[model samples]
Target: MSGIATYRHTQKAPLGLLVYAVAIGMFLGAWFTDLQSVSLILALVGALILILGSAFQQLTVEDEDDQIAIRFGPLPLFRKSVRYDDITDVEVGRTTFIEGWGIHMSPRGGLVWNLWGRDCVVLKLRNSVLRVGTDDAENLASFVNKRLQTEERE
Candidate 1:
């Protein structure tokens, strides 16, 4: 793989952060009381909230011998791959908050940039799916399109 790049969406919403902060305060307050059990429960809940709020996502790009491979995650260990050749079209666009952010499996419209508010170019592939990634969507689309067109001509 070559020309690798990775990006993630925003960390989490402010409401989530506030909830965790309140839980921490409550847990500490309970610690000064006779009920150690309350503190333990709060601590566990706080931990879970923090983990859920840290909903970070990742995107990866690698140059295959004759194509490019792109992947996104719900989990880093589990990823989907897309080849440049299989890509039928590419376009730069937008992804709104209405559909939420990150690499969502059930996106309302299409694939999204996730972290970056502006939607990057999407690859409409032959396999009946779309992919979104790249720091510079326009340039990446041009680069890939030119490469593919040149290959077709050859």
Candidate 2:
């Protein structure tokens, strides 16, 4: 028998829906109401927030074989194996405050996954680079690193 293990990251559906609703409300209110600057500012901010929030909110995990992966939008970013054996080193770090969340060219890094909150694990792989984001990401990174070390010694 083959054993398969799956870890599904938390869904940001509720948050996404809420952002959508807020954006729509702001846009509609701007069109209907007389307040110009207030309406325009709220409308723009709401639209930006909706788009950015939707993009950043995501989940990441590894299967039983320790293959790390991330799911964003309707597609999988990479199918490559983030296995411990393939990973040379795993580091936990956060983006600088200078980098804003969501659609910015230079992401300084507060958090990539805005909905889930900022915390990421950088995996130094043999061939490529991989990063996984999560709220408890530091702990998760430590957990995986320790397990890999144990396996390596054995």
Q: CA lDDT of each candidate?
A: 0.55, 0.58
TM-score of each: 0.55, 0.52
User: lDDT tens string, model 2, 28-102?
Assistant: 887887878988887888788676555545554554555655555533432334556787888896644554243
Model 2 poorest ten-residue lDDT run: 102-111
Q: Which digits, one per residue and each the tens of the lDDT, describe model 1 over residues 1-154? A: 2343322222223354565576677667657757778767777776665554443344555455566655543334434556567778877755555645556653554454354345566777775645454566666677667666755665
Q: Which parts of model 2 are misplaced by more than 4 Å? A: 1-15, 22-57, 73-81, 98-116
What is candidate 2's local distance difference test score? 0.58
Clashing pairs in 2: 95-109, 99-108
Off by over 4 Å in 1: 1-58, 71-78, 105-110, 131-134, 150-154
In candidate 1 the C-alpha lDDT for residue 154 amounts to: 59
For each of the candidates, the C-alpha root-mean-square deviation to the true structure, in angstroms, is 5.6, 6.1
**Least accurate 10 contiguous residues by lDDT in model 1:** 5-14
Candidate 1 C-alpha error for residue 129, in Å? 3.8
Q: Could you tell me how far off, in angstroms, the CA of residue 85 lies in candidate 2 after the best superposition?
A: 2.3
